[model samples]
Target: MTTEITIELDINGRSETLTLDPRVTLLDALREHLGLTGTKKGCDQGQCGACTVHVDGARVLSCLTLAAQAAGRPVTTIEGLSAPGGELHPVQAAFLEHDAFQCGYCTPGQIMSAVACIREGHAGSDEEIREYMAGNLCRCGAYPHIVAAVRQAAEMAS
Candidate 1:
């Protein structure tokens, strides 16, 4: 027998109701069920921040978050970072300008975490940004460009 739970997700200023398996992780529900593939799945064990998303304005690893726990909470993924029609968020634009990523596998998580880092007043310096973003690992070793991008985004945001 299959058991399903109804969840209301306030995603990107929109409310969506979905019936999902209680065992489903928020990452799987977003990617597989909701088709929000922008939130990548790397190291599904939560060691990697590839599945990062904003829950109630705070960055959380979606891979470790249960879908049921996110009900009625605001969940923002990369797809919701910018306005519709592909307007890049300032951080995203800065990342592009700085060439902050290579394979882009971890870019989504990096950007998500960066946004939160800046919002939480943790982007005051490169060292601070690096320390705050330490959870999101980029295998490309693009820390320099990533730091540059975050700094630029912080300037733009301010």
Candidate 2:
């Protein structure tokens, strides 16, 4: 028999309760259980940053973080990044203005990581931005534009 445990989580600024298999990943819990599909399942491994989310304000790989391990921490997915009433986060706006994505498969992760990168003080230069954002791989090869977006957002935040 499968065992399930109930846990309460603060997600996207709201309180959430879930009864789930202990083995379920935070990524699966967010996407499969909570129906927040913005955090993609790109490689299903930690190798890809596509599953990135903010756990207590730090970027984390949801796929690699067990749901139980995230209990009681406030989690923020891409859907939660925007201000209430549908205003875009500055990073999101910068991405749009910079044309940072092509097919956009890696966009949510890129934006999430970019926000953290800037907040972490890693967006100081183009090289630094590249190094900091190295984990998020864009198949469309939009590195230049992505860097521009991050820089723009960083400047805007300053």
Name the candidate that leads on lDDT.
2
The digit string of per-residue lDDT tens for model 1 on 47-78 reads: 98999999999999999999899998889999
The segments of candidate 2 whose C-alpha lies over 4 angstroms from its true place after superposition are none
User: Highest TM-score, which number?
Assistant: 2
lDDT of each: 0.93, 0.94
Output the TM-score of candidate 2: 0.98
Instruction: Please list all clashing residue pairs in model 2, or write none if there are none.
Output: none
Provide the clashing-pair count of each candidate structure. 0, 0
- Estimate the TM-score of every prediction: 0.96, 0.98
lDDT of 2 by residue, 69-153 (tens): 9999999999999999899999999999999999998899999999999999999999999999999999899999999999999
TM-score, cand. 1 = 0.96
